[model samples]
Target: MMKKFGFTLAEVLITLGIVGVIAAMTIPTFVTNSQNKANAAKLASTISNIENAFGIMMVQEGANTLDETEFYQYLTNKDLEKAESTFGEYLKLQGNGTVTNFYGEDKPFKYIGYSAVPENITLSESIDVYQTKNGALLMFADGFNEITEDVAKKYGISVTKQYFLLRIDVNGKENPNIIGRDVFVFALCEDGALYPFGGKTSSVIQTGNPTSRHYKNSSGSYACIDGKFSAGCTARLIENNFVVDY
Candidate 1:
């Protein structure tokens, strides 16, 4: 014989089994890492698109002052429905594109997606808008209806006011359905900055006060309170500073 260069059948089987075990252990880890990377990329891309839209609106308006209504109308007129759809598709979330009393929808005025909903929470709108000193529109929201101390502990970050920003203009000289009283919608946040759950709240309509906005539950209480609604409510800017092309 040729000195038995290869192992016996039993030996080969043992070797193959070891390889399979190793593969099973590492494959899931690799898959999970890949998923996280993809999600992060999608988030960054969505943010960039929104920023670009705002920039365009600002240039058209000739100034960087806008209200929530102006922003919504501008988006609708421009037919930027892709922004919301892209987000939902990438996140594997189902949303309606119509304005409704609930939070998550696929409406042209609502950016709906899944977030960390708390226990015993009802559906509600949690939108906020702000105007920056540098002519930028800042919007923010809480991904969850309420960030309880226990939940905050689980995330390893203190439950703060989560939010996002959309810098645009609303002078109305550029488009119709634009131009409105500049409103600064503020929310009560004792924790920290508002968390913007990507473009999930982009298509939502502006409920509550346009000046000082607060999320309310089905019972008409602040949606940020624990035990009021589910924990997965996402905070976002339904509409921000944006000018329309009149």
Candidate 2:
């Protein structure tokens, strides 16, 4: 009697079809969420590694502030090679070279479809690139504000500090080469602090106060908005405890 109560072939097929439809609808979203979490973790790890290395370097050099360290000296002198080499020494790097050398054949990074880019500079330019042992790419560039001032002014923002901008590609040469996703930016300040690009204000830096999570624009109609320049996304991510919600 129990066997006779079982569903007919058509009913079973219909049930299976509905299940398949549900799976199809949900699987991609699940996969995307998992990937986002993984990227966020990777980015947080890289940031921790960098801060630790900077701390260790300062301790080893008997320097209390980053500006006193030789690494900062190299950066101030615009000696990117020495800056990269010295900082690279502090961290565990697999290799260092031009962007093309490291990002070969990978799809060039986009701004998550947000048209505004840094200083209108090419994202895939031949910048100094370093790959960590964990496979994150660290790209260093100088004149953070001067280079990005035009775009900053467009949004009623200005970062008039002597800082170097660091671009981190959390997953080196990997897919989803999108800013605010796989790519983030940080500012190496003259005060020897590393800050998310849009974190500290000009007044805060001027006052010698410690940087805080006061990102001026991390939401809609401001910086880090989905369809806007994403330079502030780093600060946004940090504000969210490294969660990749946006």
Please name the candidate that would achieve the greatest TM-score relative to the true structure: 2
Instruction: Please give, for residues 1-246, the per-residue lDDT of candidate 2 as tens digits.
Output: 354567889999999999999999999999978888898999888988898888889888899666688877885665666777888778988777767777674336676664545555564444567789899998877644432545445445444454666889988988777778888877765444566755655324423322332345444322666566565677778879988776
Clashes of each: 48, 0
Leading candidate by lDDT: 2
lDDT of 1 by residue, 122-175 (tens): 222332323222322333333323344554454454433322323122211121
| Residue pair clashes in candidate 2 | none
Give candidate 1 misplaced runs (Cα > 4 Å).
Answer: 73-116, 120-246
**Residue 68, candidate 2: C-alpha displacement in angstroms:** 4.8
RMSD of 1: 15.9
Give per-model TM-scores: 0.38, 0.75
lDDT of 1 at 77: 45
